[model samples]
Target: MVDPSQAGMVAVGAGLAVGLAGIGAGLGEQAIGAAAVGAMAEDEKFFGKGLLMTVIPESIVIFGLVVSLILLFVF
Candidate 1:
């Protein structure tokens, strides 16, 4: 049986894992998205590369979610 106190701490840790990861991803996406927009403005051909770069930061959020789920379920 899980102790109530320990369960609460685990919940907090899981929340923090996902929250901090999301924040980091958002920051990264902000910078990448700006650069992508600028590059796209300069040349239409840059759209593909810019889009790819902008999307890469989204993986960070996915990773964070996986970690959070592991923490929540695996202790």
Candidate 2:
């Protein structure tokens, strides 16, 4: 069997990976969703800004992916 500490670390790492990834997705969706709502409430012209803002969360996911990769390699 695997070492308990090692297994615990793995679990922690996985939790971090998933949690961070979800956070990233949530962050990404938050702005975009907000913008969408604003646009819907305001003018159609806001569509472009909303779209741009929505995609802005992609960076967080990218960072999370990098962290995950690093963890995978190290672990």
Candidate 3:
């Protein structure tokens, strides 16, 4: 059986991993989204590139999820 303290620590770790990564991703996306919007406003042709750039920060959340899963199931 898992010790209560260990389980709590693991839970905290998982939460932190996801929470911090999400915050980081949000910050990154904010800047990229602003730039993307500006570029799109300047040129409609920039829409695709803008969208791609904005979505790039989403990978950070994905990585965080993976780490959380690992902490929950593998530790």
Candidate 3's error at 61, in angstroms?
0.4
The C-alpha lDDT values of all candidates are 0.89, 0.74, 0.93
Which regions of candidate 1 fall more than 4 Å away from where they truly are? none
The TM-score that candidate 2 achieves is 0.63
Query: Taking the tens digit of each residue's C-alpha lDDT, what string does model 1 give over 1-74?
Result: 45777998889888998899899989999999999999989999999999999889889889988998888888
The prediction achieving the highest TM-score against the true structure is 3
Task: By lDDT, rank the candidates, best first.
Answer: 3, 1, 2
TM-score of each: 0.92, 0.63, 0.93
Stretches of model 2 off by over 4 angstroms after superposition: 1-11, 24-28
Query: Residue 66 of candidate 3: its Cα lDDT?
Result: 98
Residues 1-75 of candidate 3 have per-residue lDDT tens digits of 557679989999999999999999999999999999999999999999999999989999999999999999887
Worst ten in a row by lDDT for model 1: 1-10
Tens digit of lDDT per residue, candidate 2, span 31-69?
679769878688878777777777777767777767876
